[model samples]
Target: EKWAATRAKYPPTTLALQHFDAAYGIQLGHLWPSVRAALLCERKYGALVNNFSDDDVLSDLQDQGCRDFISDTDLEVHLEQISAVGVEGESSDLSTKTSDISHQQLSPLQISRNIKCLVFPRGDITRFKPAKPDKFGLLGYYLMDAASVLPCLALDVQEGHNVLDLCAAPGGKTLTLLQTQCLGFLCVNDSSISRTLRLKRVLHSYTPKPFLSGDNLRITSFDGTKWGEIERDTFDRVLVDVPCTTDRHSLVEDDNNIFSRSRTGERRRLPQLQLELLLAGIEATHPGGEILYSTCTLSQTQNQSVVEQAIHLAQENHSIHLQVVDLKPLTHMFRKTFHFAPNLHLGEMVIPHLAANFGPIYMCKLKRLT
Candidate 1:
């Protein structure tokens, strides 16, 4: 009733609340009042607090009964208080250590070349110039960053682990795991046989290691969802980078009428299909393994909501415990937007404005607790 009243009072603010409820199945009435109050206060007192320093205004506001007049300094003080209370900052020095370890793992040649490429423009490189465009056929493509491939690679892929890339084709992330040189076998499956063959050609370019060679890497054509029924808990890691509405790529929209309807339908249908795919991926994932769920869309229905639903379903079935790895630090640095789920233990979201190139990719890394 309170929620209904609040929604009636402020229609626009309630829209996000309604969307959140529909998407994640959580009722957050207590938080709504505070959120609404904050919005109202922000509108009423924002200008006064906007430029005020801690000493100049927040102290005054507190004494004057405007407790929520949060200035930049007030935010800093709050964080300091929280830090004093032992709440962890999103990125600690541990991230630096991990980054250093990642650097150390790279060969000197790789590091030097990476640094040189960053310092010198690509076309100016002396060893090999950027390839000229092939007029005859498409030869190469570009992705925003290699970091986008990291989640799929870091998924519970260990030495001698059997992995499945359900819907894998044009293999950017599939190749990331192959490069790890750790997996026992990689089953790269796609619905399209032609695309799977293309994936094979791409994987074939890399020198086959003992773990990732001819027999270790198998390309098959199959509907991904059926894998659950055919082979349950068979893979140590599963990558379900599902198809989604490519609205972020609106610049490439060829036909407005067709594209808009398709995009809308994709947006509506994605959450349910994504939830199914994730559940199937989890079914394929061995106990104590992980699955990386990703999409190149910004929709909450496709990203966090689907993950939450999967987690709930998994809990009901006692199949696996979902642990969400925090991608907040990564998203913050990259300026990505994430629509957070109330109950998520871990996840990452990359919004459109953040990426320099193609984007608004949402990714979540989930581990199945044994």
Candidate 2:
């Protein structure tokens, strides 16, 4: 009644976001009230800083919630004002042709460390320089995906560790691993031929030539789940970023229609494949080595349940050496920004939020005890 009366009395543009609040209330349904409360108190924007120097300065900036290091002269201090509007009908001014949107010298706040990310006022970073070619390639300032970086943190790459990214595509986490640690060898593999090309482009665009051509690095196209059969207990550390239902994109819609899964049985298939890929990663990890299982979905069946099932199967097969690695140590960094699933003995979840809408990313770190 309040929303209709307000809308009828005045145009949506004239109202001070009460319409937006109501719209979200309708869309969020059961979750609206809590989300509204969170938003009412939440900071405007958040993002992680990328590729910075001077630890002291970074620390100071992080204290202020600054995330990005744009350039030496133009350190993005803060975002002053931002605006956007939805398009209902075609207008000549609104060209369909896509062009890059850039925001220079805007400050972002640091949210947490594991990957040294900052939070920002806006949820979507469409204007962020994602496609721009930097001179330093991987060494230069780059915005890493928060969800992608988390698994790399769970992997905890160290100097001279042999690593395998079993389903690496678009190479965000692969680049993070290379950037964070010195590695003996890094094998990045993806099953899809098309995605492998994109992965190569991302890597080639970001990475220095030496790292690209070095004997230590290898990029291949293959079925990731067959690694155990090909080379058992091979890598010191492995990252299995298996494909799963990308819930965020699918769960919500512009018309306020939500949770429209066309085929319910489809959900079970991905989890099965995820488990297979995870098991493959485990089998290919050296004794005493670590493996991180990750997916960009909130589904318990895909995330925690998959981890649980894998662990159970391993244990049933007399695999005491395979054990869950607790991630309690790094909880402080992400706790404020993300919701950790309760009683999460084997895995962690990065719940989606209105402030820093990154994920719905679930990760489980496992180690081979033997």
Q: lDDT (0-100) at residue 162 of candidate 1?
A: 88
Q: Which candidate is the best by TM-score?
A: 2
Writing each residue's lDDT as its tens digit, candidate 2 over 124-219 gives 333333333344544333455455666776677766789999999977787777665367899999999999999888776656667777587899
After superposition, candidate 1 runs with Cα above 4 Å error: 1-86, 89-147, 153-156, 206-214, 255-267, 328-346
**TM-score per candidate:** 0.57, 0.67
lDDT (0 to 1) per candidate: 0.50, 0.59
- Local error of candidate 1 at 161, Å? 2.5
In the order shown, the candidates' Cα RMSDs to the true structure are 16.2, 15.3
Clashes of 2: 21
Clashes of each: 2, 21
